[model samples]
Target: MNLWPTYRCAGIKVVHIADDWSSATVRLKLGPLNRTIFGTAFGGSLSAMTDPFFTLLALKQLGRGYIVWDKAAEIEFVSPGRGTLTSTMTLPPEEVARIRAATSTGEKFLKWYATSIVDAEGRPVAKVRRQIYVRRKRGSC
Candidate 1:
């Protein structure tokens, strides 16, 4: 995608983006580009993989009436984060429906979600938490 190099997240390639509105996963690989001096994936890159999913998923499933944001985030470094890291993001049908029901009344609230950062071999390297604000825009929709 055009955004891979624009934001310097080239190593953070999006491997799977399904049209059914169910899932997405950002892939990481070991190479000279995104590596640190210790030969590990950069922590910032790991964190960056998580940014847009929450908002994009919400918009895709909930339609145009609501606003979603990456309100807050925290990460736990569980390993050396060597070789590579992959972050998988998913939004279940029930949760998406819940958001629509809660915000349909035109009120705003802060919501939170979390994901795990895993190595190439599927070991968890870190845990990430994200907060999003949901609301309806005035006079817009």
Candidate 2:
């Protein structure tokens, strides 16, 4: 999403998305647009960096028959982020299987996923949790 206006303006970049759509790595660089006055990563930027990946992976993996939406989120700032920070989001196979089974009857399922945004040294800058809603499409069952 590097070229997407919101991400681009905030210096957020999608570093990689796995071929199987199971995971993704996103980066936020400390730059003019995303840094706080004290020269650390902006809290909003840190939070924004983690906004969509988990649901994105879920949607891609679930493909055509399901609807996935990022239902909720929370972010805890662990430390000041200088330089670059990265967050990698993954949806495990078992979780996907569980989602499939849970939603097979057209019932909605809510799943929470966590990811740590870390600085260049691998120290945590923020801890983020995202809850996604998944359901089978009405006519797809």
Candidate 3:
């Protein structure tokens, strides 16, 4: 995703996505393109760094029989972000199981996940919450 326009332009780089699709790490550099007037990380960039990760991880783990979408999101700024900031998203095995069981009967479900964007020293810069929508595809149950 480093080359994706939205991420590239905002100075966000996807550092790692686990082989099993259970976790992903993203980084955002506080550069001119993504720096606020206050000389901190731009709020939009901080938020963008977290978007799409949870949904992507869920979809990959759920397979073709399931449909997953990013239903909603919110970000709370905790402090000024300087230098490079990192965020990691993880979908636990139990949570994946829960999602599968919930939609096994062809029911739709909504789940919320949280992550934090932190600076190089591990100070939180923002807290993000993402709501994911999931369901079994018709005839795929």
Candidate 4:
């Protein structure tokens, strides 16, 4: 089940997912349902829009032999998010390799990734940091 479309009700739209699962772009549109009383994007919506991406991307790249989950997250609102805002999640190949190497012995790996939510004009609205937990499943590798 692809979570991108499933999360649309929250005003989060998945704009793109790279073929390699190394990158993804998601947009949070400012609408009645997702706006605050100040007419800006709701803070909760901004946080929710970024909730599952890092873990999901890692899961896809790590394959079935690995277990991945969202361990923690933090969002700093820099400015009121007006109009449509977007954030791109990217995991470099080196990072993936490092994760794999670290978890090769069935140990857990926790890595933090950062992304910026920017407005239509490309100004920063918020900064989101997500820590993902990953491990190699026992007997699978």
Query: Which candidate number has the best TM-score?
Result: 3
Estimate, for each residue in 1-112, the C-alpha lDDT of model 2 and write its tens digit: 7888989888899999889888889999889988888999988888788788888888888889999999999999898899989999999777899999999988999978
Give the clashing residue pairs of candidate 2, or none. none
126 in model 4: Cα distance from truth in Å? Answer: 0.3
User: Candidate 3 on 50-92: residue-level lDDT in tens?
Assistant: 8899989998988999999999999999999999999999997
Q: Which is the better candidate, 1 or 2, if ranked by lDDT?
A: 2
Worst 10 residues of 4 by lDDT: 1-10
Listed in order, each prediction's TM-score against the native is 0.88, 0.96, 0.97, 0.94
RMSD of each: 1.9, 0.9, 0.8, 1.6
lDDT for 54 (candidate 4): 90
For model 1, residues 1-141, the per-residue Cα lDDT tens digits are 426573355477777777866677877676777778998877787787887787777777776767777788888888878776788788877888888777777887677788998887788988988887878766645
Candidate 2 lDDT score at position 64: 90
The true-versus-predicted C-alpha distance at residue 39 of model 1, in Å, is 1.2
lDDT of each: 0.77, 0.89, 0.92, 0.89
Query: What is the lDDT ranking, best to worst?
Result: 3, 2, 4, 1
